[model samples]
Target: MVEVRMRVNGAVRSLEVEPRVSLLDALRDHLGLTGTKKGCNQGACGACTVLVDGERINSCLALAVQYAGREVVTIEGVAADGQAHPLQEAFIRNDGFQCGYCTSGQICSAIGMLAEHRAGVPSAVTEHLAADVELSAAEIRERMSGNLCRCGAYNGIVESIQDVAS
Candidate 1:
């Protein structure tokens, strides 16, 4: 077992886990943070997405020990003082979910994606990689391509992110 220590949901969390334990399992089975779902245990689905040091990643693909000193932000960590993040509010207002199984991952991914865009990181669909990328429909789609909504709520998800970005 490996000893892992990280800040999760604004609290310092320290635990012993198998070296091979995935971050998703550590969070859900160990820490009781079940909001981050397990969809495709593989990286193909975004259901296990979470933020490590403010960047979104597929928790299923990450080892808990690998994130020992990082700040891990799950869906439960997005709110502050019992108030939802603006993106969370926008998702609700835009009806961005159906079954909601993918909502947590989508929201976490959107939060990181917005941060990347704001930092001038270009997406594959950005016409001019050297130019500032605007948060257009195409841009949003490209940025969120990694997240899949089995409920086919792409339109609403995109709208929600766009709303929050604007």
Candidate 2:
């Protein structure tokens, strides 16, 4: 077992985890933060998405020990004082999910996506590398391709992201 310390949802957490333990298991099993779901248990699915130091990553692909001393944010951290984050509220208002299994990951990924856009990070669809990328529906869709909703809620998901981005 290896000791790892990380800031999760604004709280510092320390745990003894096996070297092979993924961050998803560490959060769910060790820290008891089930908000980050486990979908494919591989990098292909975004259901285990979480933010590490403000960047979105698949918790299933990242080992807990690799995240030591990093700042991690799960869906639970997105809200404040029981009030939903704007994206969360937008997801609800726009019906961005169904079955709810992928909602948390979707929201978390969206948060990072927006932050990336805000920082002027360009996507594959981005035109004119020197110019600010437009937050068009296409851009949003391209940037969010990693997170898939099996319920076919892409329309609502795109709408929710557009609502938050606008």
Cα RMSD for candidate 2?
1.5
Candidate 2 CA-lDDT value:
0.91
* Model 1: per-residue Cα lDDT at residue 48: 92
TM-scores, all candidates, are: 0.96, 0.95
lDDT of 1 by residue, 1-166 (tens): 8889999988999999999899999999999999999998999989999999989999999999999889999999999988999999998999999999999999999999988887778788766643244588988998898899999999999999889887
Please provide, for model 2 over 1-166, each residue's C-alpha lDDT reduced to its tens digit, 9 standing for 90 to 100: 9999999999899999999999999999999899999999988879999999999999999989999999999999999988999999999999998899999999999999989888878899887443244488888889999898999999999999999888
Considering summed lDDT, which 10 consecutive residues are worst modelled in model 2?
A: 126-135
- Give the per-residue Cα lDDT of candidate 2 at 81: 88
